[model samples]
Target: MSADEKGDFISNNHQVQPIQNSLLPIQHNPNDALPSSSNPRRNPRNMQGLLKFLLETTKNEDGTHDSEFSPMDEERKEFLMNVFESMSVNIAEKLTESLKVISQAVNITQQDDPSDCENALEVLTDLVDEVDVANDFMKIGGLQACKPCLYSPHNGIRWRAAQLVGECAQNNPLFQHNAVQLTFLDDLIKLVDTDTDERVRVKALYAISTIMRGNEKAINFFHDIDACHTLMRALQSDSDRLKIKVAFLLSTAFSGDQFLKIQLQKMGFITLLVQLIMEALEGKKITSLEHLLGALISLSKDLPDALEDCRQPNLNFLNILDNIIQTYKDDSACLETVSYASSIKQMVYSYTDVINADR
Candidate 1:
């Protein structure tokens, strides 16, 4: 099925891709001692031992590293990745036990150390990124374990927790559905509404975006929570990071829902999207042009159908879409694909035929 047709699809190129790179930086070191033939670390039998050592080393005993982990030095994170990658299957198999330790470090019920939780989330996020552990993670109550951290007093802890949840929800429909069932998305929306920290808000918005991705049920749940208004407020933020993420969320959620398309246009999202594009054209903010265009394209394709039953349409996004396509045709080749040009071209002709038939 095409991306737009899938029930749980998010573009492979969206900000979710960055979460893979955001948590870990793995580069083999020439002087590292873990890979030697005689190195005990090479033994897969020692994987669980390695995991325990990591947890002990990272736990904060006296707030010495409340702001960060002194033990999680570059050498340590690299070593952790090295060992974890070597035994991903075994670790995932033992994920329930491993989660006990990992969760204790982060779970507010088990620990209150923000630094420990932050560090634990970092490690867990990196692991989830490396493997399809969403089911295993959720199976072991990971969703419940991580939920409290979203409101942690520490910005880093909250940020990392939010990032981890979003990564888990990526491309996993069941996980997304479970997240909604557990009201995780509502908590995240509440984070967006109340968090004073921009970093935390951005992460929360990104997670909501991921959980809502292409799941029609989740998207409907989003409306039930009145998240569209929350997203609109985010779109007006001065932070381009927030704007790009919320715009991309709209694009992903807009892919398969016809009802949402009408609701979104009624909220004036099409005009806001066009304004974002115009800002990019004027070189005011260049970071989100591709995502903004993607959202506009999704909207363009839906507007005609969304408003087909209206007695008198209030606006002509088709005309606006035609101008956008013409204006950006030359630059479209530089985007992720030329499909935007072709898709909009087809939309223009389709709308033209409908209008001519009426005339």
Candidate 2:
């Protein structure tokens, strides 16, 4: 089924029905001709008249009410769809007006009133939601709309935008190219390094992880651009959230193509990867430990190359593999670890056979 049909089906299934007989016709209210003494300062008659007019206008021409309501509802839904479609090309323009209104309100309040910040937050949130709606309509365009919000003046806005970007990047590998082309990495790195808001920085780190995950080109690009050091620095940030995100990114990169992995290892990434795993083990940051272990397993798959690059003998690598096998011999909780150990053993044994044959 088409996306629109699916959306409509879901909407119809989840929609709440309006209360029966709740809509009173306009111009037929008993209080239209009466005046209230309790509210001398208020104009109750005028209010009643206005509500009556609205009710009457909403009624069908055939004297049967709600006959036209479904068509009107469908029209409104179509208009909303159009608005979402136009969001990509017109987001910057629409946001300009919204930002201006927010800034004007903030200026009037002079930052003295909490309500000013609340209003700004509300507008910013609506803007982000609109962008997300657009993304659901057209993925790439919606991502573009959210890109500028990463630099928004309000920390809350920046954090939300960063999250949206990461979510978009995670959904499509093509978004990885768009993200990098938009210099998303530069913005995220700056946020990671200089942003005073820890939440914003943490979210930026997550965006980095999302952009890198399952994206070989992005990993190669980062390796070629020598951004691994900056990424590693983020792993050392005080925020455990940022550290975990950075570790995941690194682990993903390490598990990519051998060329990218070798490039990163040549740039001294293996040491950082090992250090991160050790730190995670010690600090109980088990969130990405399995991913890290999988990355290490991939690295171990090419043990001969790593040994040669590090100028170490194959015997040394075998000894490390032996230790791991012994440690996870009967540990049920470490099933993944045991599987990795078995793979490492196989790689070592294969290498030894080849070496002896050459000799």
Candidate 3:
């Protein structure tokens, strides 16, 4: 914000609250695994010496297995790495192969075997999850290979392509910067605006937020556009996944910049968020309400003056907080909702105190 509007106005904020970077977990069905004719649990030795070799790696230096050991330990990594290599499917090797396969698939029968493309995409998504692998991915033209899939008619392929970009760029400044150079920002924005598939839209926005989060040029580029309105439409969307992500992205986008918060407040973001919260509470379920509440707390944190929007008597912010706390307190799943609700309740209390002191 210190820079001129036409100049570089955004950069990294090391103090920005860390986003919980995660992909929607791929639910690997046991049936999806490559199966064998013999059941290993019934009898270990039936499948040759493979089972014994696995157990041998777990043996400690004293020749007794460390029953409490976890895979995170260095010894386990060194011992188990050979087992992974022997399986002939090292992740880097297979993931590189998959990148080529998808590129070729897109060039060939894109429609004939969507499952093959989708499966290959899912495999590459694994590469994006790890930083080192993500680097290797970019070095080998992973982004260009993925571009064709982004336009695939299959919804699964499109969403997975977006997810690949989002996962690779999250919390990674170098990747974020490169994503901008490759014009991923423009493509992702267009994807969010026009994609009919809700999953695709959500992942596209996820990638956009990550790319714009800390990079100066990317954020400056976005500043000239209707970024707030794009977010507003997302909040008004029917997809709970989209709304939750948009809410979290608010914090990421607004942090370390009062000018941005002022822009949001002017754009009626506060009023819209209140309406969304009330709608979620008045309905039968409030699963995604937690993120909405967190957004409010983030946007209003440490403000010199409480928002006039929050002080509206008709909105009754305190009552809403109380209802959320009471309803979600005992519900195990909404525990985060309760905590965020409590934080905002205290925020509202502080707001009220400031209002009364002025009176």
Candidate 4:
């Protein structure tokens, strides 16, 4: 009876234990704290966890601490460094290749809902933040692919196209050199001067400013076209964004090209700016006062002949300048505006023509 009972109980217990084990939830291994296996996100700068894992694997128990870490451990460290660096280079290349593929996929023809084109442009817009990626994008005919999109009936496509151009051109001399060519520059100016969509106008102006800012060849390109006239059209556009962007470009984008500055002056930019500043002073809606003030200061410095335009009593430029300083002297948010306004007044005061002028 004892043998039969014991044998039957043992066999049944084994079977029941197997089923229970299968039904139980698996335990989590704390050692699996690494980021991922399918898409690893290891930080090269902060790889203490990986180093610790490698340390554990490479440790020699031959003499504990004495032989725990040897020359082989240093070699392993160098190998790990090389692996991470190679991985970084590979990731960058793959990312650039993905951008290239996506850029070529943006079809320029009319799409009922060009959201695919828009989404792809958005991806290109973000990825071009890296200089090498941007250079790679420009090298892979990304701009040529994007050119027709600038004329897409869809506003999103148009604006995103211009924005991607700007992203590629921003602080990128290589892209600017490629972008400042005649066809591209003409297209950008057309958008800035005539695009019905304000978003397109703003981004086109952004692209233009980025391309034309620091490049002497770009400035010469501007002179060849009616680029100054294009900018003047921007000043008059109903788009406040265009006005602000124009003002910003005026302040910082002339690249000390005296001819362009004098061209802007002769085109009555001083009078136009005076009108804008007066409107701002009168509380008529206008762009950033700081930017407007900065543009005027830049003009006065760059175009000496502009001082007479600023002094035109018909416009009452001195009165407007005083009003600006008084209005903004105490305004914390308008420190830049006040500084620029005061600079203009100080510059005028230093002139022999206005030395006797009333405060």
TM-score of every prediction relative to native: 0.63, 0.52, 0.72, 0.70
Candidate 3, residues 12-96, lDDT tens digits: the string is 2211122232323233333322223353322122223444544544444554655564548785466446534443445556666
Q: How many pairs of residues in model 4 come into backbone collision?
A: 0
Query: Candidate 2 has which clashing residue pairs, if any?
Result: none
TM-score of 2: 0.52
By summed lDDT, which 10 consecutive residues of candidate 1 come out lowest? Answer: 14-23
lDDT of 2: 0.55
How well is each residue in 1-359 modelled by candidate 4, as lDDT tens digits?
A: 25543353334232211111111112334455443346554333334445655655555455544653335578556757764654333324433454554454445445466666677787667667766667656654566777877878788888888899888888888678767653677888888877788889999888888887787787777675387888888887666778889998888877387887787888899889888888777874424566777888887784568877887779877788888888778878777777888888887556564555663
lDDT of 3: 0.70
Query: Each candidate: what lDDT?
Result: 0.64, 0.55, 0.70, 0.70
List clashing residue pairs in candidate 3: none
Per-residue CA lDDT of candidate 2, range 88-159, in tens? 334444434444444333233223443443344344444443323323322313444455566666676678
Q: Which is superior by TM-score, 1 or 3?
A: 3
**lDDT (10s digit) by residue, model 1, range 231-341:** 888888777888888878877776677777778777777677766665665563435766776776776674674234221233444454455556656764445423553
Alpha-carbon error at 284 in model 2, in Å?
5.2
